[model samples]
Target chain A: MIIDINAFLGHYPFRRLPHNSARTMIELMDAHGIDSAVVSSLHSVFYRDAHRGNEDLFLETKDFGSRFVRVATVNPKYVSWRRDLDEAMDRWKMKAVTLFPAHHGYLLSDVECQQAIEEIVRRDIPLVLTQRLEDRRQRHHWDAAEDLEFKSVLELVRQHTKLRLALVNWIGLDGKRMAEAGLQGRCLIDFARLHVLLNKDVDKLISSLGITSIAFGTHMPFDYVGPSLVKLANLESNPAIDYPAVSWRNAARFFGLEGGD
Target chain B: MRKIDVHNHVFDAVDQPGANWARVESMIEAAEWLGIETLCCSRPITGGAMAEIAEVRRANDAVLATMQRYPDRVRGFCFIQPGNGRLAIDEMQRCFDQGMIGVKLYNQFKYADPMVYPIAEKCIELRIPLLGHSAHLTDARSIAAQPMTSDSLEFCKLATRFPELILILGHINGGGDWEWAIKGLRECENVYLDTSGSVLENDTIEMCVRELGVKRILFATDQTMEGCVGKILSAQLSSEQREDIFWKNAHAIFARRTS
Candidate 1:
């Protein structure tokens, strides 16, 4: 039950990588033993229309069976956001939504935005928020993050009470601090971009978070899967916590795939 | 036999640029074939201005995924842009609180840049080592291209500024920088070097062996994208030095840092 928790489809304008079809990505995932992936669309975020990417990603995941779950990147701030969400679920059949606050340019705490988040939570669809992409020093756009106020994101999550967030792009240091701050119980952090420090810390992190707050991810189509999976496969975690169940089971439960085989 | 890797990187696989899952898998398959106990990968480090915080955070998301993927075999470093002190600290606290052991800095940015002082000070106060690039004998031309020596000096300055912090200078070979680094960094007891990159000049290793002793040196591969076998075997110091550099020194540092 290996799950690649973090993934994107379509063309990303910032990175000059060729876009691979979802079928090709699935083949690649199969080769790496990734049983499932939570996918978003790169083109949608770039164009400020997650629907385009969400439509393609939804069609792609439906064909992949349970191996791929459609996690559409949504921008609630859009006036047509209600139609967008309905179409994404009804038309695309997606079970999750990934919101890019910085790229989408709407504070999570916005009144309308908070209402939308509540609606998504009411639907029981997982909401994954992509925090940031690059270190501030290395951003392709110098001022891309200047207007980003993460407090709004955190506060929104706290306010929702029932909102369970799947945070992507959480680095080593920040992820740990979030765990220490007790964000893990309510928010699951997908380790899609972590690399540094000691291997033992992985077990420690999982243990600290009680496994339920953890999920496996590989930022695929940008980087390869070998190192991504190897980081986990190489750890010497206790056998009980080191199983695929810990990797995929918790994620399956979080995303409402509890009965998934 | 707990092994620690202080540097690494992970990118989004869904929108891959260079190699895909197969490429990275085979590479790791090869590493596993060679018996590397563990390796830590970082969120991808893209070179650019400090204003690219969002991009950095995106890269960091991938890093978080990697750490969660292999909790036993790998750990992750929070690659930070020193320009946003407040945000960077928030990220450091976030990742560190999540159980990350330290932070990483690329030489593309300076160690002594005024923007970075706050970050260094925080790491020192928190007792997390800032793993960064450094060279001993640097070529001025390559220095312009990479700025290894200047960054190394600034690393020393960082140690001087925050005496309790541990600054691990990555890569002790492929140039004469390690040789010169010993002189500049020796006075700062908190400063240490990780034996990585190309093989060190035996004389340089010997000098470090006698002067700084093995305790000041550590064994690292800097081989995130490369094979780790060669780098692991590259620690050509004596068995005693090997003990300290390969495992003991890291354990000591980890113990203190973790506490």
Candidate 2:
């Protein structure tokens, strides 16, 4: 069974997604052999108060049961974010929380963000940070959502060594640098945007940074899932590497959902 | 269907590690995994950016060597810096004489620059396609690093000036206004948009097929084979159209080369 760590539901304001609804998303996943997915709401990216978006995501995935895990969004820019996060964890039972620093106009170093990270760590819930939602070149002509500063995120991760942070949509030199900066076991990287792994460097990356911290994530609806699947297939062909660990085991262990299925 | 990747780089750069013969072999394995039959490889622009004319020649020679090694699986494109002027033209001839299939113009000079005309004319004379790197950004600050970056409009202008030259405007999906870039090349019959670049947005390939028919679009991975295949598969095109973009068009275009 495959567990996709980065999937989204709801409309993307920039371009129309082929499968934006939960039903279509599930159908898409099933067609692609995805057993379960940790999904967030695209609405939360643009919303001023991300709580409403989180509530929408909760309602969307509530009926899907374990097949679809809800990942709530909390914008530290809002003053009542801590309450929203608590409600998401306690009431909605969200297993993860995602942060859009670029869209929400804040840095990972912000005090509110730090407090939220601490709260999430205290609750043992994973924190997923989307480094970028859309490709910088493809952003709307007027949309000014810059990429989240990698230095700031690295600094934050350094401070919170035990924090379970999953950096999503980061690839190439930056991703490699982050991994090389002693983030191998400390932080997890979503494979949805690691295009370089599709090349000959897959084995090199695996050797340098073991497969434990890498997780399967297909930024579905925003990005096609086929590429990640291709990367997984390539990894599976190699007998030396543990493809299952990256496919689902790592994510399963990270979310503490191991042995449930 | 058979596939020919028209925009693949095969070189080890100073900054990007693991770019060696073993790496290219792994890339070829990955491409073969997806049923790609041939990769028309060229040295990456980053490799030629800091090198002297002799180094550039050595880089092209390395590409030729890889082609010779792979024979059926790999084809070499002579990468030239138009700024080298007469020496660039001579190097193109030298590589062509040594079995290089086509010309790959990097971002050393704009597609619209007069310096590129001689190279375009050389490609036309050699009956080879010129694969020029094209992006859509107009912001001076963004392109300050690679000042020679050309947009599709510049390609259109270049095509108009050299009607006989077959200009393959590469990387339509490389983080620029691709819609405008694709549309700008609508009337230029000799210009083809390659499906390369890193970002593969939904409907991008289909949109390119819609604006410029499948005959004018060539499948390319830019050395990112898996992602490129995903982009092509995600496109809502029929089997015939897929075949055309995947290999037929590339075969038809590159077949005319004297080499």
Candidate 3:
């Protein structure tokens, strides 16, 4: 199945998002032949109260059912995170949790983050970390969100043993650092930002970082799905890459979808 | 419908040991999904912060070789550094003689700088477009690195100076403020923006169409092939408008050679 591991719903402040609604998003996915998308709310990344965005995310995708793998955006800094996260997982069926440490103003090292990480680990749910959801350089003038640093992820991997960390957007660029951080099995990455055809980064990365580490993502609605599809086209040509693995198998495993791995 | 990629690059992969049509074919094959019919390719100087005249010549030579090798598919864009002064103009002439369709400028000099005027004049005289490497950088550090980087603002400035110049501000989504870049480009009828670069902001292509009209926008990848192709494909443009941006506009620029 073609799955977009990183997708979103909700209005982006900078640009008019035509495909933000569930029906429009599905139409876009069908137009692109994407079978499923792991979706969270875009406002969740910036909202002061994480549950507010999660509530919106659940509301948006509730009609589509499992066609959208609802991922709750959790701010460990928020006091009622534990209860809200449980409600999102149990009540809303948000199968995965995404953390915007850079946006929410907490490092993976923070005490609250560690607590949330432990709880997520206990539940055996994947914790996805998004970096630079919007290109920081192109962010709206007043938006102060910074790109999540690579080292912060390294620290997360180094510290949390069972954390199934899924890195998204440009954060997944440095395969070398990821290889160094030992981010193969437990950690997964989306390929929206990885350059395959133009630069040899993806080829070199797959050789070293292993093919299973990468999965399909387009940063859709917020961005276009075209680039990831292009990257996928290039990857499919490489005999070394297992097309199915990057296409959907690894993503299924990462996001706890059926038929994964 | 034919799609022309007006801004793309060829690395030294062709010069690598035992390099064959396979490398070029792979690029074309990769773009088969997007059906990229023609690629206007250039190899800008890779090693240095600024390119010298010799380096500029070598880059153009690389472009010439690609164009020759894939004559039907590849169109050469002569990459030059205006700082090379007389030699740069001469190099542009040499590439034009070799059938290069346009001039590709890196951050070696600003588009509005006096040094670039001679090259702009050369492009105008030859009826070839001058595609400037551009970005509207906001941060201080990035600005520090590519200080000579031209943007749509500078392209407009240059177009104002040379009204007939077919000036292309390369990669609106390349980086920095695209809203700023696209807005700045509206008044300069002579300046066109290529759809390339990595960032595929939703409505960016539509915004360009809204502001600049379909005739002036060019389809380009700048090596970020999929993103750009995707941007245009997913845009709120009709098939005819898509064809116009993807092929006709580039066809016009490449066909405009006088001598």
Candidate number achieving the greatest DockQ relative to the actual structure: 3
Worst 10 residues of 3 chain B by lDDT: B13-22
The pairs that clash in candidate 3 are none
Candidate 3 lDDT tens digits, B1-259: 6899988887764643476655566677656756898988888874336766776777677677777778888888888888888988889889988898898888877778898899989988898988888888877666777778888888988999999999889988888888899999889998899999888877888889999999999999887776787678778789999999989988887766753
User: Which docking band does candidate 3 fall into?
Assistant: medium
Residue pairs with backbone overlap in model 2: none
For residues B30-77, write the lDDT of model 1, one tens digit per residue: 345435455556654544344467766666666666566566666667
**Judged by lDDT relative to the true structure, which candidate is superior, 2 or 3?**
3
Instruction: Give one digit per residue, the lDDT tens place, for model 2 in A1-261.
Output: 899988889988877887778888888888789988888899998888889999998888888878888888989879788888889989998888888887888778888788878887888788988777777654566678777767887787678776787777776525466565677765667777675344444455555666777778878887777778877886787787787788888888877685534
- Candidate 3 has an interface RMSD (Å) of 2.4
- Of candidate 3 chain A, the 10-residue stretch with the lowest lDDT total is A170-179
Off by over 4 Å in 2: A172-187, A195-210, A258-261, B13-20, B44-55, B138-141
What's the CA RMSD of model 2 in angstroms?
3.5
Instruction: Give the winner by TM-score.
Output: 3
lDDT computed for candidate 2: 0.80
The residue ranges of model 1 lying beyond 4 angstroms of the native Cα positions read: A146-153, A172-185, A195-201, A235-237, A240-242, A258-261, B1-259
Candidate 2 CAPRI assessment class: acceptable
Candidate 3 wrongly placed segments (more than 4 Å): A171-182, A200-212, A233-245, A258-261, B13-34, B46-51
